[model samples]
Target: LRILCNYAFNYLNIHKIYCKTDNQYAARLYEKVGFSHEGTLHEHAFHYGKYIDKFVYGLLSRDYLKK
Candidate 1:
């Protein structure tokens, strides 16, 4: 996933990428690839008839370059 993210960032000339996912598994994967928790949108998402918080994670090119 890190490799894919790197490729995407490079391909798009993006300096940063932010991700929002409710899947805990994906969230953990994102963190493993260097995404840090930026903030959360409280009750910003609706799932299973209830509102759930959405976690915002981001990674910058500089941060990835440091790795």
Candidate 2:
């Protein structure tokens, strides 16, 4: 995750990276890797037999460089 962020910010020159997930574990992993919780979309996606909330996380180039 760190390597990917480094490449995106340094080589690709991306201003920001966004990730969306419905799993708590993934959300925690993103946070541990420097992503900030931006927002949530309630009942955004359907999985299995029910709708679930979607979590949005973001990391900016400047923020990524600070790590």
Candidate 3:
């Protein structure tokens, strides 16, 4: 994740990056890497048989550079 962020911000010249996950641990992992908790999408993704809530995380170039 860090590598991707570095490349995105440094080489790709990305302004912002966002990701969504249905797992709580994954969301925390993103937060640990400087991503902010943007929002939660209620029942936004479908799994085996039902819809699940997805957590959104985002990081901006400025924020990534500060790390």
Candidate 1 stretches greater than 4 Å from native: none
Position 16, candidate 3: lDDT:
100
- List the global CA lDDT of all models: 0.87, 0.95, 0.93
Better by lDDT, candidate 3 or 1: 3
Model 3's alpha-carbon lDDT is 0.93
What's the residue-level lDDT of 20 in candidate 1? 92
TM-score of each predicted structure versus truth: 0.86, 0.94, 0.92
Sorted by lDDT (best first), the order is: 2, 3, 1
lDDT of 1 by residue, 8-62 (tens): 6778777998999877898899999999989888999889999999889999988
Residues 1-67 of candidate 2 have per-residue lDDT tens digits of 8889989999999999999999899999999999999999999998999999999999999998986
- lDDT measured at residue 41 in model 3 versus the true structure, 0 to 100: 96
Off by over 4 Å in 3: none
User: What TM-score does structure 1 among the candidates reach?
Assistant: 0.86
Quote the lDDT for 22 in model 1: 76
Question: Could you give the candidate ranking by TM-score, starting with the highest?
Answer: 2, 3, 1
Give the Cα error of residue 20 in candidate 3, in Å: 0.5
Model 2 residue runs over 4 Å out of place are none
Q: After superposition, how far is residue 5 of candidate 2 from its true place, in Å?
A: 0.5
